[model samples]
Target: DAAYLQQQLQITLEEETGIQSTQGEFKFMVAADAYEETERVKVNYTSEDTLQQASTSGTQSDNAPVYDSDGSTKVV
Candidate 1:
């Protein structure tokens, strides 16, 4: 569950900030719920300015997918 949460958090952070962060140490604090039983997943990300610059000027455009279709998107 930690791994899945980490991946989801990474994707969400990247989409929001355009920065990717490696998973650092994680700490979990659990408290008993009175009504329901569920734990919230919270994510924190930190990236250096160099990483931001690299991501901005990196191969993002080159990594875009191109499709050859007649005004329609069809997957075969």
Candidate 2:
């Protein structure tokens, strides 16, 4: 659905009032590029499942996690 939504938003709507005529006169939608720039969510997960568990003991000097500039993480 992300690809479909992205495709639909790419079409210029400045002269396409007919597309939204039945909706409402005052309705507005944010531009596609604006949506791409905004943050959606940041969740810190916690669980007992093997693949899903997070470190409950938290950060320690020798075993601290390293976060990269590109948003990846790794155990040090």
Candidate 3:
């Protein structure tokens, strides 16, 4: 359930680069899209990085943007 919740958390592009979502779901097309349109702005890490959640007690979590060799985001 944590993973699912985390994924929901990552659904933030709607607030960042696109229009607000309806229950976390958004429209990803105009005449047809927007990621490339917005230059792929840095949003929250994807649910794949949920393990990097904020500190639970006193330890901090390391959450840095991960990029593939091609310089594209690996998790975002």
Clashes of each: 0, 0, 0
Could you say which candidate leads in TM-score?
1
Report how far off residue 65 is in candidate 2 (Å): 0.6
Cα RMSD (angstroms) for every candidate in the order listed: 27.5, 20.9, 28.5
- Sort all candidates by lDDT, best to worst: 3, 1, 2
Stretches > 4 Å off in candidate 3: 20-76
Write down the worst ten-residue block by lDDT for model 1: 21-30
Q: For model 3, what is the C-alpha lDDT against the true structure?
A: 0.53
Q: Write the per-residue lDDT of candidate 1 for residues 1-76, one digit (tens) a residue.
A: 9999999999898776643222221112223342124322211123455677688767675566566666664443
lDDT value for candidate 1?
0.53
Lowest-lDDT window of 10 residues in candidate 2? 39-48
Query: What is the C-alpha local distance difference test score of each model?
Result: 0.53, 0.52, 0.53
Pick by TM-score: 1 or 2, better one = 1
- Worst ten in a row by lDDT for model 3: 53-62
Which portions of model 2 miss their true places by more than 4 Å? Answer: 1-59
Give the per-residue lDDT digits (tens) of candidate 2, residues 1-76. 9988777776556336656763454343445445544533212222234333334344345477689998799756
